[model samples]
Target: MAKFYELQRAMRAMRQSALQRGALAILDLGSTKISCLILRFDGLDPSLASDQVGSLAGQSSFRVVGSAITQSRGIEFGEISSMQEAERAIRTVLQSAQKMANLRVDHLIACFSGGGPRSYGLNGNVKIENQIVQDEDIARVLSSCDCPDIGDGREILHAQPVNFALDHRSGLVDPRGQIGNKLDVDLHMLTVRAKTIRDLAHCVKRCDLELAGVASAAYVSGRSTLVEDEQELGAVCIDFGGGSTSYSIFLKRHMIFAGSIMLGGNHVTRDISLGLRVPISVAEKIKTKNGGLIVTGLDDRDLIEVGGETGDWEHDRRTVTRSELIGIMRPRLEEILEDIRTQLEIAGFYELKSQKFVLTGGTCQTPGLDTLASRILGQQVRIGRPLRIHRLPQAYSGSTCSALVGLALFAADPQDEWWDFELPSAGYSSRTVRKAVRWLRENW
Candidate 1:
């Protein structure tokens, strides 16, 4: 636990340094596409005023100085499968973005969709030392949380104090400087496969770029797609990516749960390729051009040319009705939705105050997906796109870029995590805590 917090503190320090330098890169390492966005900050302190940092962290001021999107290679299900190929792809995108910006970036904050993320809710309380909450009190309460044994081969990705309480008064966003005898907190800790993170970090290091921070694509997608009210009340944001569909639940403007299914749009494309005996590339094109969940009488009469590169002329000229295409696509989509429904049930989503579901990401572009999701995942479903950022191109301001855009907003004004507090030297016994304190002192 101490090591995890130390790592988070180091990342936070790196992020602050990047902000002070006025330039940072946001990378979305997905299964199908790797996106890079070079943001040029105005060197303005986000803490200039509360009102300025209240919503979207003054995102309107930061501009995307450079951007690039390229096909991902040697990655599957959001994990790097081949270091050499993934490194080459990262270099390709970074070079393109740097060229556009006419400036090179050495620090990057990256988000990825895969990692076998698991969320845990923890509660902690500590008596106020001086009858008023202070930074030390906050840190004590946070440190009081008894982290569950998440087992080996996993590491903490996000440890956030979502709620605070002072004596009988609960639902406090921040209890500091308040008169209270006791401080309480509800924390959400997200853990992911250790190997997945190590590989990504190694890949970034090999590219000669410092990894300032890393985030789960699912959580960032919710940050970009879910509106303020939806996040405050309650909502689920499902990011349908190429090789995975990740969903996160938010309540009171904090993520409470996050999970991902390995199946996604790539499965649909592969289904089409295998079922129709077409090349993977052709199947992808067909899926993009003609994919839909709804079929009508007119679709039966509408024939789509499924051209093939096979030597046989007759085989190359075959056609299939839109209805047949829908038949091949619907089952796989339904299966994915059903799996998401099951996960939602496990998360107790129905009990939330507002059960709104927002669908976003590359695959959610399918026609009638909102309606289909409403039926399969229940009502109150809607398609979502990333919130508009300063000078973001129309081409990149879609659902597919939600994670990348959110990473920018997050980089500007991150949530108050455990490391944001000052821990008492005597409270922690681990040698790791001493190292963390020293690191924090040096970084700050």
Candidate 2:
């Protein structure tokens, strides 16, 4: 636990250093595409900024000075499958973005969508030593939370204090400077496959770029897609990427749960290819141009040419009705949505007072997806796009760029994680005792 906290602190310090340098790059390493964005900061403190001037109040302190994207190779399900190919792809996108910006960046903050993320909720409390809640008190309470054994091959990616409480008062966002006898905290920790993270780090190092920070794509997607009201009340943001479909639940403006299904847009494209007897490339084009969940009566009469590259003219001139395409596509989509529904139910999403579900990412661009998601997930569903950032190109302001945009916002104004506070070196052994006491107090 101590080693994990130390690593997190080091990463945080690296991110702070990159920010102080006034420039860094954001990378979204996904299954189908590799995206890079160069952001230049103006040395302005986000807390002093106005909402009207930035994407999020006190968080939009950077502008996109350059952007580049390339087709991902040797990556599957959001994990690097081939080191050489993934490295080449990363180098390509970074070089293009740097060239566009006419500046070189040595630091990068990256987000990815795979690695089998698991979420755990933990609670802890600490008695005030100085009769007032200070930074040390906050740190003590956070460190008191029991760190669960997530598994052998997994590592904690995010350890955030979602809620704080003071003595008889609860629901405090911050307890510092408050006169309280005791301080309590509810923490949300997300863990992912250790190998996946290590592979990403190795790839970045091979590209000769310093990895300043890292984040889960699901959490960052929720950060960008959910509006303040939805986040404050309660909402689920589903990110449909090419390799995976990741969803996160937010309450009180903090992520409480996050999970991902390995199935995503790539699966749908493969289904189309098999069902239509077409190549993968052709299937992708058809899926993008003609895919839909709803099949109208006129669709039966509408014909879409599924041209093949074969030299035989007649074999290349095949055509299928729109209804046929929808028939092939709907089942897989339904399966994906049903899987999401099951995960959400397991997470107790229905119990939330506000159960809005927001859909974003590249695959969510398919026509009629919002309507289909509403019927499958819930009625309170809406399609989401990334919040606007300063100087962001219109082409990159869609759902597909949600994670990238959120990463920038995160780099500017990150929430307080466990490592942000100062914990005493000797506090590790007391974690189990604190957990037992809290359990007894609540149960007895």
Candidate 3:
């Protein structure tokens, strides 16, 4: 925990340095495509902003200087399967983006979707040392949180203090500067396999780029796509990616849980390929051009060419009705929705006051996803895309690039995390070190 605390603090410093330098790279490592966004932070806006996060005017805070997206290789379920291949893919996109931006970027923030993410709820309570809460009190309360055993080889990726309560009043976003007898805090800790993080960091380092910050794909996309009412009351954001589907639960504008499913859009493509006896590429094309979960009376008349490479003229020229395509895809899509429903059930999502569900990600645009999802998951389901950002290309303003867009916003102005505060470690609390620093300053 101490080592990770220091590592997080160091990354915070690196993020500040990146912002100061004005160019920060944002990377979204997806299974189907690897996307990169370069943001230029020129100057602050005059709009009134929250003290915790400097600016609320999202669009004006940062401009997209450069962007690139390329086919992903050696990546599956959002984790790097082949180090060299993933690194090569990363390098390819970075070179292209830097060329477009006409500027070199050293500091980067990245997001990924794999590594078996798990969430835990932590609680801590402490009596106020002074009449009002301060930085040390915040740090002390966070440090006092007793975390459960997250299993071996897993490390905490996001440990955010989701809610703070003063005495009996709950839902306090910031307890500092407030008078309180006792401070109670609720933390949302997201953990992933340590090897996943280490491999990602190594891959970034190999690319000659610094990984200033890392985020969970599920969590960041939720922040970007879920609206204020949905997030504030309660909502489930399911991001359908290429190789996996990531889901996060948000309440009171904070994520309480996040997880990933092994199956995603690529699975649907594979099913189409097998069902239609077409190549994977052809199947993907067909799926994108015509796949849907709904079957209408006219679907039987709608025909799609299932092209093949086999020399047999009849076999190569086979055609299938839209009804047949939907039949082949509906089962798999239902399976995914059923799995998501079961996961939400396990997370106790049904107990929340609001059951809003927002679906985003590239695959989330599958023709009849919302209609089918509403039937399988719940009645309150809507397809979502990332919010518009400053200087973002119109081409990138779709559900397909939800994670990339979210990563850009995250890189621009991030919300506060536990690591943002200086903790009560020996380096922070040791009197001898403080005295030595003071004495050196006085002597000099």
Candidate number with greatest TM-score: 1
lDDT of each residue in 165-249, candidate 1, tens digit only: 8997999997889998978899998989989889888989988888888999999999999999999999999999999999999
**On a 0 to 100 scale, what is the lDDT of residue 279 in model 2?**
94
- With a 3 Å backbone cut-off (N, CA, C), the pairs that clash in candidate 1 are none
Order of quality (TM-score): 1, 2, 3
Q: Residue-wise lDDT of candidate 3 within 367-436, one digit each (tens)?
A: 8899999999989999998988877999899988888888787776566555677775545556788899
User: What RMSD value applies to candidate 2?
Assistant: 6.6
Collision pairs in model 2: none
Error of 2 at 62 (Å): 1.2
Give lDDT tens digits, candidate 2, residues 1-444: 556567778888888889888889999999989999999987544654644454455355678899999999888998888999999999999999999999889899989989999999988888998898887787777767778889998988887888898987988887889997888899889999999889999999998999888899999989999999999999999999999999999999899999999999999999999999999999999999988889999999989999988888987998999999999888888899999999999999998889999999999998888889889999998999998878899888989999988888888877745478777766446878899999999999
Pitting candidate 1 against candidate 3, the one with the higher TM-score is 1
Better of 1 and 2 by TM-score: 1
Off by over 4 Å in 3: 1-5, 45-54, 424-444
lDDT of each: 0.88, 0.88, 0.87
TM-score of each: 0.93, 0.92, 0.92
